[model samples]
Target: MHHHAFSRRSAGIHSLPVELLTRIFVLGSQFEYLYEDSPFLLKPVQDYSPAEAPNLQVIVSHVCRHWRQVALRTPSLWTTLHFRKISHIQRATMYLSRCSLSGTSNTYLLDILIDTVAEEDYLPGINLYKNELRTIFQAIVPHVRRWRAFHLKICDDDCKAQARQYLSACGPAPSLETLQLYHFTDYRTAQRLYLATYRPPVIVFSNTLPRLKNVSLIGVNLPWDKSPFLQDLHHLELALHLDNIRTPYAYWDRMLRLSPELRTLCLHYSGPKEATAADPALIWPNLDDKIQLRSLQELSVTDLDPDYLCQVIQRLHIPNVNKLTLDLPDQNFTPFVELLTNSAATGSTDNTGRASNTQASSRFHPMEHSSPSTTPPDSPILSLRNLETLIVRALECSPSSLISLLRATQALRVLQVDFSRVGGGLCQIFNQDPGITPSAASLASTGFVHHPLLPLLKIMKVAGTPGKDILNTLHTRHRLSREPPAVSEKWIIGWDEKRRGTDAELDALVDKGYWSFTGQGRKVRVIIETYDDEEEVEEVPDNDAESGDDDELEDEP
Candidate 1:
């Protein structure tokens, strides 16, 4: 009976049109790459092994005669090549040869990933050497013109030197669009010791990549003035850059000006050097003349120096940013707060099509809008009118500043905050009663008004358990509203096991049906997730990559 069912299913799939079947095979081969919150680091879920990787084309070609014909003819299925072990060199060559024989007129572009980092249990009694990597690079370097995306991961110093040699030796890559190079080493320790031996400079394709739009480099340096691929990039990420080989401020300014079409920019402890009088050659931009990044949508700056971060933020004019992530140190949020305050004072539009500064003052009687003393007509304004999602880590700001920031961003839909580093005063805003009157002490001290905050919020994720205050806010928003309530759809709370007794009130609220509102076929969901500690919880990163133990890959043979 099982064999009959399998045969019937197989017949149904085989009866589809040839074009549709080929597309299905092509779509099935594509996989998503997962990264950590820090964009440069890949999520290390398990040990790297070549045998565990997915090979969708090989599986479909070995299934049956009809399926094999369709799979062999689909050229897109053989574009991605993975080389992690010495044994995989043969497989990479096989993929290239299969693409040529797929009966296509034009040459297919390749997306190659070469990981030279050795794992202990990958292959017993065998280690990947420099010559093995060179052999693999030599085989693919000949087809540099047909490369679309190239990713290289090296752990050893010797392999780094060889990779740089091969990259410099290659000629122009006209079709290359994405380039990523990662050195798996702790850059913090290296920076502390000023160790220049482990961190080597990388020069790719001899500055000949014209079509490159996405670039990610971690623990590597490139001569910024000589590289041509750094301009007009759609996505650029640089992390863990050493101070000894820092790029000057002038080059950094020029690069940002050239990349006007950038959509995503992530600078994690990397960018220009700090502005100091000691380096007279490092010319800083004037406050009035800012580099306009009108097309940028997503921006991330993590682990940057506070003074330098302020200088960088003041020099850019980003008006359409919708998603922002900041992982800064405590008491380092003044710059961002000033941006929000200035945006509100400059009469930026709110969600209600009114000036945010006026709306904020009219909605709350006690709160006042404080504008800067001096105003310039042509000053660059960083507007948060279109901001929808915000994620902040290690945020520590005053209550008034936080209030002004929240008022400016009335269109926020999703908010994620690390409450472990926040002060008690900031958390009180979440518990503010929207229906009740404000007390005399509250109005005098914090000038907080009993008004609804973040009315359009749909999802909220808190890194620490927010006990009864969060519950009170949610209940008030749902039950005590004159107009239609904009209650959040989902609230995810990360509970620490150490705070077991403190979450009793939160548990009681959930037991009671505070979230079971049936208004216009809408209901709220509250998710309580428990974790051991910060280190243990952070170790398990996002699993957005293709699963290694997939049933389809296992059943291919």
Candidate 2:
């Protein structure tokens, strides 16, 4: 009855050696099909290719049959897919199915990009893909238990609303640990999701999340009155666009009420600068004693006012906080800087070894060290003797004042100052005593530094036109103290030719024997022999004219 069918087995696969089997399992497990040449996930041949992203994967497959099978089985290598277009979505999903975590009974984690912000800006491009958002969400929404991570960005408000409605309808994410809502059009969907089923004395989460660990709000604002919906999160990031409309400080006051398991909190104060802006922290009545951020260890801030920034630092007793970063305001307020450093509760805090070293690295930085005259920050103002990394940004400061700042720091090792910050109103500074200017004047400690000085100072950075003079001054100090020439040899004085320094040339600085290399470092470093710009008037010329006038006067008489 019949022609029997014969199935050809891979020749060596049946009797493959144990070592070969293990290597093949490792290779197949590690190999990602998306990295291989298939119509589904093909990448352009270039220096940077996804094929290269899976370099180790593709190479192992060719090593042997066993290796190829092993490389094909690894889920971690197959996890993330960059769905550039609608057409690629179905194909990427097919490949992702191979790494399905059903075997591990764990959800697979994937980073998906439906549309980029810039891509949404183009009209035709958005119209082409606008409808795909709903379709894609529909497919993935049902498998919510499998979703380890999801980010959907759609520009069309209608599409965004649909996506939001679907997610808000999906109920609470039990397996979902990470959620990022970027460019969300309708926040009310979330508002209703968190508040609709519950009412408040506003204690939102009650035996809430056991798995949800991280949540970030970017370009999203929660109601000033709304409490945080996620409970027991290990990390929280909040980046807000306040529409310049100041919300109540009690809004933030609510976040502090959470379980102290929180390790990192990134909060930003953003709102439109309304016709008049109000300070929320000052107005909040309950803020008087809520300073304890129980489990919070690290804090980061950006583009905030000096006063409010200080209030946050002073209020929060972050015992585990060993790292601090300050993006100094243009106003150059150091007291504000000091408030942030005060957050580190020293002595009571033992951050010795790695922790203490990290604390040591975060100290104040001098504006310029290679300059003939050094200018730096007033360290007592920042009060971070335990700081580890000090990053000073564009600083346009008077030479004498900056030098005073450097002299004040007792633990400064790394210093950076970019002269670009010298705002145009600079003419306004010199006309008045520079030390009296707003930034330098009001600092709790005067820009005039008074300290034994940092003994561990190292790594000096200064850039921009104005830095030239300051850098030269620093080099002179280094030379005298034999400061081991920490500066780069290629550090030419005139690196920044754009600003071109001042109308009045630099006055010479004389040392014990060596002629001081003075003058702004940007232009020709005018190595002067002596400090004389004025010549003495010859007495002989004056005397000859006086005698001639006297003789003429006698003749006339």
Candidate 3:
């Protein structure tokens, strides 16, 4: 039966054209590379999971003779070359050989990742793995000119020294576009050793590698003055622990001006000091003061002071920015409010449409549209019309401020209200206080105090546990409103709370019909489901690319 089933499945699958099958195999090979469920790069080949055991090239080849021939001919399926342990050194060479086969183009770009440094801590005598690093470097060094994206992450200083020497010897990488050279040790402790020995050559391409774009540097020192690596970057991340060699704000301004096509900018402990002279674009007294990030769409700043973050935000003119993540020392929503409001008012970007003139229905009362006094005079007073997703981790703002923000962002569709770290202020907004039984009719009578809270809010995902008062408020809001904007019984009430064991209230709502509509002659469907934290993980900042002391603000745009 098993043999017959295999034959039936394989018969139809084999009928697909070789071109389509090759594309499928190419995508399958990159399964480990794209979605990183495991740290396969850090582990040896033998330690790979069963899913990753039979790589794309191997899995397709195992099907049949014709499949094996097609897989062998597909050069793209062999582009990625990963080197880790001593046993894999030969495998790296063989893969590169296949990548450079006669059938493929001579200029087929290669994506190389060399992590041969000792995974464990390096002691005095036990550090005999230098040979492994040298072996891998020698095997992969000759093919540097064809590198499309080169990632060298060495934990040991000696390994980095060898790798740096090899990289310097290669001179100009004409095809190299993305470069990530990281010394995976605490920058503070290893500062002395790095300054003494690891003096890498200034990355001057001399008209080579003009297409270079993304670069991520961590604890790796390079002379920025003469380096072409700093130019034409679309996405750049710099997280060096050296306080003395920190790139000043003026330098950052110059760098930004150089990279006109830059889209994504990430800064972690990489900003200039507050006391330093402000950039030309940020000099407030100047008649024309604006930093036009024409192409910038996404930005991530972590571990910087609130003042610095605000200064940076005020300076940048990201008209197309739709997603923003603020991971500051404190949850100060003032800057966010000012930024979003200004972005909406200006309508500088084509993405943020002008606010609709249609007035709110009888469900809410009209109030004065008051913005923070700190906002610039010329700043627009519109909602964050383009912003659809917002993730707040360190939520420490008042309910009034939170509600004010919600009202301003009429186009917001999804909100992840994280209250895991802070106190229970979020709970107070949703769950009216103990003695205060704020009825739905009373809430409706008053209408909306300010602008209606979350007019377009379709999903509300709370990180921590919500109280009975909060749940009741949502129920009442849905029940009272004649046309409850977007809320429906079938609408989702996603819970991402990390508390152990099932809640009695939740179980009652699920098992029995706890949601009651007494005498109203109405029924609603509130489908409760476990919220996957993976959706929120993108908002967090990359710790490896950012400062070690910085908190995580996982976000994606």
Candidate 4:
């Protein structure tokens, strides 16, 4: 009798205001998804199994009658529609209706994400897949005017052709702000399709997207000159083969000129999957005028022809850039390193002023037949005075070049070097030169014989087993922090499991607590008597109390 009375007196959650309940539902819908700010290729339905119900809104609505009413009325909750399967058209249609406030007025802008790949659960036929894509794409066509952010990842030419037709049918996209289109297919398939039909599939959104600020096009052909899509962009990512675009560099320079507000740019070469005899030889673009980026902060160039990359870097003037990342071939590193080394050195701009036109052209020459190491000596010096961070990946950079580069960057604070792609020992190369030894190469050195490098460097993150001097230098830095009262420095190193057997010095450092084990340890089997050893060796803890403690080092005077 007492329990029954208590239940009767308590109020239920449904009695809360609808506005508060709507906010609660929105918060609850914040689930985890992998496709955040990066390109994602949608997998098959079997991969997404233990499948989520057809409609998430319906699932939430069916919880109670009050929830049903509240969810159906919340237009914001239905604005984003992600289609993981081809048969999700029913749920999409339901969402389209609910996203609208009234009978005729579609007040809310939509963000659409579609993955047009057939799954194992669907019937096994190419025609069926094409048909499903057509039906869904047609349904979404009427609402193209309201799209604010549209991302599409499709795999075939038929789908691309169909999408082109739909986009051409739609008029101006005034509300659009971000657009990403990715085509995930091998170059062989694209080549065969191209051979069958002499022309490539192109989508021309002429003067449609005015407010667009961020755009990413991966393997999608577009008529860049004819469209207004390149104007006023702040973030742009392009991954396409040079053969696919006739005048790639002209379009790039024009985009830079039109958008002085551009901040981050990533350019990656997407060559054909397999080489073809008919593929045309690459012709370097003529860059006579220099492009200036006043507001740019970060730039990344990957998998590009070394000569072209050097040409582009030489022709651009970026005074305020803070971070630069490079991932290119090892043979291409010489000219790039030379350029960077000169850029980071003091008084490089003054040198550029005194440089001759012939010298400048020779320095920026497209080294068509010669190697990067054989470039002329009369190159103009550039300056990257504002650069603070540098990241290098998948390139075998020599120790001398790296040391030279570091010496030039007086303002650099963070350095990241990835040696996973190198075929040999990292320590053997860097430690041979005692002149640039880490302990002696202090930025405070100001004499005739010694010169300091990496003056403001505070953080060093290296991947691979380096030599003992590298460890000693880090240790010395840690010891010097006490007298000057410097901020606590951090050094992170990652080495491969295969290196464990051969890198004795690395093991000693790990034992000494100068470095810690962070990566996945290999599985081993151990036995007391007659069996093979396969057990994880116990990791040694950082012993600060026993010896070589931070307090043991003398304070710097």
Candidate 5:
């Protein structure tokens, strides 16, 4: 019986055509390498040995003679090459040789990733020397014309200099589509290095990389004004540069103008330098003529100066943006709040800076406060009507200001807020009966009365211990008789020695069925997660009360 089953399996394997087998091999290789999610550079750098080169191709080729023949004919499977360790040199060469055996005049394009550390901090004894690095580059430099994406990550200053020297002279890359250069160093060290050895910007590619559509540079500076590589990009990420070495607003404006089709822009502690009285000219060209970014869909600005962030927001028009993430650590939220509230007064400006008459009448105007001196009566709130997901961290603002911001996002579907980092009274806005609570009543008197706060919201995620306000909010939403009655809520609580008894309240809520379905036949799913000192605790399963099965809650440590 075993022999007959093996015979049937072998026959089924051989029945597939060579083209289909090759295609399967290609997809398997890509999945092993995570080809679609290439350039995993945003993650924190770790001092570990390089991952073993994916052996999927080699393993399949050794399965049988027929599989070997099919794998040998597929060149695209070997296009992704990584050279992070000394042993990888041999593997890279073998992959390149296989790509050359396609029997075609034009070889397949290459997606290369070079990640290395200095000799002193080498992994175990496998130190990647400068000569070895240069040799690897020399081999790939010949195929620069067929380069599809290049990612370079260096850990120390010496390796950074070596990489810059080689890349500066690599010449024009006609087929290069994505370029990412990251100097991986600790935050303090990077800041010190930039301040100590500040120098004029250097040009990397003398010829414009015409096809380059994505560029990410961290702790690296380029001639922003003259670099042709910054034009027509679809995604741009810049971070960790010191203020003195940062580009001014004019350079950023120029790059935005050149990349009209840019879809994603992320600035982390890096953007136009802040304006000061000593150099007032830095805020040049009259920001009144805002740059229109109609194609921008995702925007993230973190650890930025409030004035600089306000200037950046005021100088652009992102009408179609759907995702926004902001980290506000400062107490001065006036500038940001004013921007959010006054956007509607700009006459509903479109991407072309033309005022549309249709939305002018529908603009949001806050109600008159009893004390007119404290409120801006005619101020129009910004219409972030298209925003669907918002993640706010370390936001310090008044409850009224937070209400105003939430009021603008009528179409929000997902909201994630770190309650530990947020100011007090912001969480109370979720309570259904606003007239009874002072904070909620104050928010209601504002623009929140016309419509519910984020009525279309489907998922609300909060980080911090669960509180009565959050429980009340959940209870109120779940009891509603509306079509979209309730939202799925998740609470992330941090456990520590001092905070051992904090979960008692949450435990009581679960026992009282506050996280279960309401009498109205609407269900509210609640997820409770705990972590201790950045170490994740075991995740509890989602409590789906719809089944009427009560699961006992585990005590968090």
Candidate 6:
């Protein structure tokens, strides 16, 4: 009895006025799909009421009576028919006729999205309306030319081509500003069958999309680069993979040369797939440096190592490319740093004065350490003066190793070193074999002095366990520790400690304000003392109790 009463009360509440209920009910728009209760009862077959069906068109009808009339009045809403609506086309056509009563002068667009495009499912299920859909597209596609945007995305190329058969029924579309084709059929059979007869470039040469601004071709082939005459393209992403075309030097040159107005050019190649495997002599040709790209701004490339890519960048000499994304798999830290040598330091610039327009300001100074180094000879030479942010991911750096790297760069502002050095160190290399530690000795013996880098570098962010001296030397500013007063004791302590320092070298190091440290037991802690203008002094820690005990024992004896 209570459950029945609750149900009755809920039903009465749900019966509230449509104006008050519409807001709460509109939540259904956010949901992507609708599901039926079960297989038990024959699921309620959607009645496909053109007027009552939940759709973008009908949803607008509920906005208000004015919108109801206007929404029902626009043919565009009714023209774009979904494939699922075939179940109620008769009722849909009736609703669409009234919706678009404004006539073909207003024009309209129709779009359909489907789950699968298998020939078996398509031929039998949609064959009944295939002719009708084709007729509608033929009528709409040609007349809707002047519209700002018209798009049709279909998985099955057969359905689209079949729909295009009716194109003869419509006139040329003039006002279309945007047209998008995605997941277009590979049409492999047609590609091979029509390759010999393909004359698409000929047709496209005369047909131009004067206003087309964006083109994205993923895994699509270009019969010829000369066509697809896009005059105002602002962005382009043409994915190339495993292109074994060894002499592609001309391919991109031609493409960029043709697209003079392009602002952003992004190229992604998944492989070094040679276009001509038989031609070993076919070296990757260098780009023409004199080639001028007027409007190009940014360039993004992925899946290539630093050494080869740096060479490519040097050859391209794009003055406009400001931002670069290096997504290559760099196993060794050497290559990435080498490329840092090529960063535009001074005058390197595109014709547009973009970030890539900066030029080199300094010579590449090799470090004097000349130790058995971990870096390679062929690493790219990079300059960091113009570089702002550099993100190095992957585990290939440690504190000591990075100290060697940081000492080589000048313009580095933000540096991040993740924990790649745990349980490893230069000392470990010496422990494995004593021969590795003598590189510093070799340089010292040879009297070779090479200044690594300038102290202008700041803002170093390091992760992982770091050595105390390594961190303190490169990071923190030095500070003096205070001690209790005791003039004679301080002198004696200083005298004892000074005994280890040869007077001459000690004096020189002190004259240069050398910072020194004392080790305790086996630990790496430093013994420090404060300084004042009064006089030179050093004080040891208090051990009075032990001293008193010793004096008492000596007296008893």
Assess each prediction's global lDDT (C-alpha) against the native. 0.63, 0.41, 0.53, 0.55, 0.64, 0.37
Q: Go through the candidates in order and give the clash count of each.
A: 0, 49, 15, 7, 0, 30
Q: Which candidate model has the greater TM-score, 4 or 5?
A: 5
TM-score of each: 0.76, 0.54, 0.71, 0.68, 0.76, 0.41
Candidate 4, run of 10 with poorest lDDT? 524-533
The window of 10 residues in a row where model 1 has the poorest summed lDDT is 364-373
lDDT of 5 by residue, 1-557 (tens): 99999889878968898988998898888675543443433332344333434557766766677887777678887777777657567767867877877464156888887877755667643546566677788888878788888877777666766777877888888888888887765535666476334856667765658899988877777876668678798888887778776776667767787787988888888887655435544544333445667788888777776655665665566767888887787656655755665566753332223333322122222222221222122223224888898888777766666776777787898887877777644346554236453343454465333234677786666666465666656545544323333355554444444554666665555445445564465556666554453444343232223111111211111
- TM-score for candidate 4, please give it: 0.68
Please state the error at residue 40 of candidate 2 in Å: 28
User: What residue runs in model 1 are displaced by over 4 Å at the alpha carbon?
Assistant: 1-11, 31-55, 85-87, 102-106, 118-132, 186-202, 343-381, 425-427, 432-450, 495-502, 506-513, 516-557
| Decoy 5 TM-score against native | 0.76
Q: Identify the candidate with maximal TM-score.
A: 1
User: For model 6, how does the per-residue alpha-carbon lDDT over 439-508 read when each residue is reduced to its tens digit?
Assistant: 3356457763323232232333333322332323311221111111111111001112333344443333
Question: After superposition on all CA atoms, what RMSD does each candidate show versus the true structure?
Answer: 9.1, 23.9, 11.6, 14.2, 11.7, 25.3
Taking all chains together, the TM-score of candidate 3 against the true structure is: 0.71
- Candidate 3 local lDDT, residue 62: 55
